[model samples]
Target: MPKGIYNVPEAYNEPVLSYAPGTKEREQVAAAFKEMYNSTVDVPMYIGSEEIRTGKTRDINPPFDHKKSVGKYHEGDVSHVEKAIKSALDARTKWAALSWEHRASIFLKAAELIAGPYRAKINAATMIGQAKTVHQAEIDAACEFIDFLRFNVEFMTQIYAEQPVSSDGIWNRMEYRPLEGFIYAITPFNFTAIAGNLPASPAMMGNVVVWKPSASQMLSANVIMEVFKLAGLPDGVINMVQGNAAEISDTIFDHTDFAGVHYTGSTAVFNGIWGKIGQNINKYKTYPRIVGETGGKDFVLAHPSSIPAQVATALSRGAFEYQGQKCSAASRAYIPKSIWPEVKELLVKAVKSMKMGSTEDMSNFVSAVIHEGSFDKLASYIDAAKKASDAEIVVGGGYDKSKGWFIEPTVIETSNPKYDTMCTELFGPVLTVHVYDDTKWEETLKLVDETSPYALTGAIFSQDRYAIEQATKALENCAGNFYINDKPTGAVVGQQPFGGARASGTNDKAGSVLNLLRWVSPRTIKETFVPPTDYRYPFLG
Candidate 1:
């Protein structure tokens, strides 16, 4: 295994696997390093600061493997679950009593810590652990997460400053309050930023959080806990327990103190948890808040006047980044037949030029999918596409598993909208392109709507004002977030709210004040200058 640069032990003298700056060899080096680490390392790494099973001190694997890592949490028999809830309940009374400013200060300190000494190591670990390219890892571990922290603090500031007013002699005041019980954060593996938002948002609002991170990205999650600790957050304020899905769900759902669940995963899991919450509704002191962001079959509509180069760049990045594992990743595109040739040519060139390999290779723009399961699923989609009469692979459709779960960036062209490739969510580095005649613009819009049950995100590329306007209005309900002349994947922290309705889980958009609202409950407090001296007034008379 390559020696980790940021937190290498003094006695560790192995040569570090250095990537050639800006060269594709960097991706090769990254893949090589990951392969070595996964195959050679024998110990299971803990996802939290303290090992739950052994209750011993241990150094974390610098570049942990996602697949081989096991859950550090032991099955808490019924008694342990009771103790966890009691701990949270005991902590909440004091945590909720603290001023909002005091709570926000800890998040500010966390942002500072992430940007300072912890930045490099965290970024490196994310790259190795998640198979994210160095640039992608930096964005996930540093830029996006820091932006979320800053945005959350700013949001709390605004919420605190705004005052309620009354016109007459009466006075009314309203303020947001944290749920008096524990908040559970069930996060995904695609983005580390999402992991931070799940718990941190509620934590900033003075709620105790029991975070259950995705099993695939536990190391990245642990690094987040380290940052939170360095920020001086009270230990019990944020507690992390790592376990498998069944174990986690059982523990979280059965625990009476689990007041709220913020989730991002498959729709099935979301619905299952919702059912559990409903079944156990009366067991809790209050109703639990359930917020989720599920699957999305995001689309991109290419008008005839759309610039080929720009649209190609947008589509390529949106479809292939993180191997299209993100919920918002572009999976389908609607192109007018009038400009089909130009669009196809540009897309083919773009996909062909993309360097795909290990993330450590600086020149490689695309990295491996997270694991073998994703690899198999992506391959199945490609095989299914190969048999389609109207569909053709425009770029890549091959996979190699010797070193890592690497698949070639692929593009498929199909004239039939009914093709399964165009209709289903292929969450991988595969794009399905559908062509429609200009006369069928309205029909194509309808097809896009019918094809996706998810209304998460959709984009339009058009230079004409009327075309952009028409498409925007028509597809408005097609996505929670709509974009023009931009990719759907790069939704900013403060600017864009990032969730959708219908099958795409709840519309509790992350990264905005709306999401923060779901984590809290508003309370009304009224104070009078003097007590009412007379029980009877003019109205009573």
Candidate 2:
């Protein structure tokens, strides 16, 4: 719909079936295809019984099963957070009083449910709603969230076991306590696992949560809620609300009872929320906790000694995974001149091999971008990059939206580091390749830190110890999560804490104990057998 971008071809409107023809196989595939297509059209899921008049709507285009309805949400203004806060406040008392074992039990149960019966439904919903390949959807709906559930339970147990302090004849212990009030969780559409963990973390820590999921991810959210319910999560312990930003913000920020906010989205929105909280800082009974992860223009650096084949593989996954929609997706590549030719050829070949088609096509890797609005933005960036400098479109750089939102996996070779595409966060299937001279590697590293405002995730590919050390130090302040010879995108739950600094995020790395820590407040409870009357220790005396 927007200028410069094209729509998906009409030929891809229907699901492409390649199974052996038979009554059983035909019926099964036909039914699956039917369900997939039906999820594309917008369907409303009301939360609080208020009519949402916001004109915002999803485009249920083809390639996506047109008959499949997109989930709609009717979330109205919570002019007063008083009720939601009260709900959470009350819920927290009972939730927190439960032993760690109880909480962990339910969490594990939820994970089991997710992996068991809900897997197919969740996978299907994600693939249709987000246009994810079957494997990608399965990874998100089943694997990632399941991992988060199991990991958080283990991590929270460890945090609880940490002891405070003890002195001669005096023993003191410190315990983590949940905020007495409600926690508001605002999640992003990119990772549904984020949606599950953001609210669940705080809930597990004995705080009640109010979740505001991204509209694009409502279907996934619904499936997650189902899992939680099946796990026997207490009624009203977690509430899902969907609405425009204004209504949600007005409700949550203005509430005096809100104890914390967990958010992941654009920097602008995060900053705006921060400012509002600052303005009303004195209105709250307790200091509110704020944790967020925002945007990123992650980088992938290739050294002279780096293998050309490995670099290509990493870049290909980083640049095009989820259509470059991931916050940590590598958007920039700085390849040394020595390995530039080899890296370039391999990368181009790898890009060419990526299959582009409907998600139902199991082999198709490239699917439609989430919606038309995003497609338009991607097109603008590509066009602006072309006009602003001598940037060349290396591989693919167009869109076709006749049936659904689809963009070719695009790569651009730019001569100028300051090219708009190189600097900006293009959350689409687009990558900018910049070749650098080996002699000027240090200067290039400096340039990387300087040009990009985001520092979420960055990687370097090299075996040289000195080179790795130098680059690491130089780019130390560049990314929150740094990698060596690894793709920045596929961050594991327990191993690599995912998040960035600067414009990228609040540095609250998800999938780690750090994220769970953000949900709680540690309080020291000192008990002495003799009730020390004087505030003097044996050492001081």
State each model's C-alpha RMSD to the native. Answer: 7.8, 9.3
lDDT (tens digit, per residue) of candidate 2 on 307-359? 99999999999889788888888899898889988888988898889988777
| Clashes (N, CA, C under 3 Å) per candidate | 3, 23
Q: Report clash pairs, candidate 1.
A: 26-360, 26-361, 27-361
TM-score of 2: 0.88
* Model 2: lDDT to the true structure: 0.77
> How much is 51 displaced in model 2, in angstroms?
14
Models 1 onward score TM values of 0.87, 0.88
